[model samples]
Target: MTAALPRADVAPVAPAKRRRHALGWLAVVPLLVFTAIAFGLPALAVLDGAFTAKDPATGATSYTTGNLTTSLQGPYLTALLGSVKLSAVSAALGALLGLPLAQAVVGSRSRALREAVLTASGVLANFGGVPLAFAFVATLGNAGVLTVRLGLKDSGWDLYSFWGLVLVYLYFLIPLMVLTITPALEGLRSQWREAALNNGATGAQYWRHVALHVLAPSLLGGLVLLFGSAFAAYATAAAMVGSAVPLVTLQIADALSGNVLVGQENVALALSLDMVLVAGLVMAVYLPLQRRSARWLDA
Candidate 1:
């Protein structure tokens, strides 16, 4: 007998699947191209420049680790540390304030109240940058309405100070914390509490053993997000504090513009690389915890 031929249907099935796969990929092409142009290419350029140094006299370029080393020294190091400190402090503060607010919102009896808070949080979380700076300045600055009326400047309060920056940061940070942690808070089931109570467990015991334990991962994830947000923020800080603050973002801007020190463009790129690494590390820690938290929350 002749060798059995593959079924006609089977022969077309492979090509059909291949065509479907190609079409699926075609749908993603626009996104991939956009990412490459907006993020990938710029990131590659930063990475390339961070490792390359140019000679002023010869106008020649060479690869070196000098930029990385320079980034870790003196003012650069200080700015990096400051950025870390600011991010950590602001994140902590946001968590402290937001946890209670989120719990309040989640526990509220009225659906309207919950929706209102969430809607407000969403708006306020994105209400940063120059307009936010202007609003704060108008409300709390030296000549601001509140400051002028309260005479707070005479009380040794300056809106341009570090603590002032923290206060301004809180305006958005708290709302961000609320938006992130609200869903996690809502994930907590009433049955868990009832079960604990039926088992003769106190409220404190339930929270200590069950609630907090389950919520810990999500809380940490929210903090990580807030930290990253604070760390990468540039416009608000730029508008509110200008060069008065020694932030890494400001230093990067100064270096890139050749305003603070000329020939430090590579150093700025190195700083940018440093920021990417920091943000990457935060997300690295966040993602696994977020995944673990989601498992329980979704259940």
Candidate 2:
């Protein structure tokens, strides 16, 4: 039997709309190209290096999982765990401190003050790495001005220690959290507060039951962002504590430099693979929470 005739009455998408859609997709080409070059190629390189090794005597290359296995087995494991702990602590503290600061900024009567705080936060969030490390060391290091004035050295406060590195991480992390959570704070409607008050809900109750509930997703997303930021950090921690801090980033650098053992560059790439996985997992959690928060905010 002959196939059924085509539906001649079917409507086609408008040519204008079709052109607009094509343009939209075309507009994304640059971003896709940038991602391919910036992230994709680098990722492929890391994966390739991570699962392969070169024979020193014969100079022959072969694929193997030994790099990953070795990465997870020894001091490498300690560095990974240390980075996780530092990221967790710093992210938690940043969220805790930054949330209230953002709230205060959002609730302030002074517009100038709000803008100033936000601008400062924007600046400070990007203010990290070697300069940040140097600043912290000068201000909080053993012979730092504050250290000398406060006698922190006598108090056993060391700026090159794990906790001191965490404290340095906070310098950027808190500002980052403030910037991240500010928009979420502003999205909390004033009408909700008024209605809660009209119903005899105290200020604390309104925040506890109403505002906090709405802001939870955003807060968690911001926390995750803070976590990823701290986790992937390299320069600041490297500059601040060097080998004193048992961090994955530093370990990667060490492996690349063959500081501990010769011909372990593949192990460095494996460590990088581990870091990418951790960061990917954090972003996986963050993206969903970010979307959820945006939906609530739009509501």
Each candidate: what lDDT? 0.95, 0.93
Give the poorly placed runs of model 2, Cα more than 4 Å off: 1-13
Candidate 1 residue 151 Cα shift, in angstroms, is 3.2
TM-scores, all candidates, are: 0.92, 0.94
Please give, for residues 207-274, the per-residue lDDT of candidate 2 as tens digits.
99999999999999999999999998999988888899899999999999988898889999999999
Candidate 2 residue pairs that clash: none
Tens digits of per-residue lDDT, candidate 1, 119-172, equal 999999988999999999999999999999999999998989788999999999
Where does candidate 1 stray beyond 4 Å? Answer: 1-22
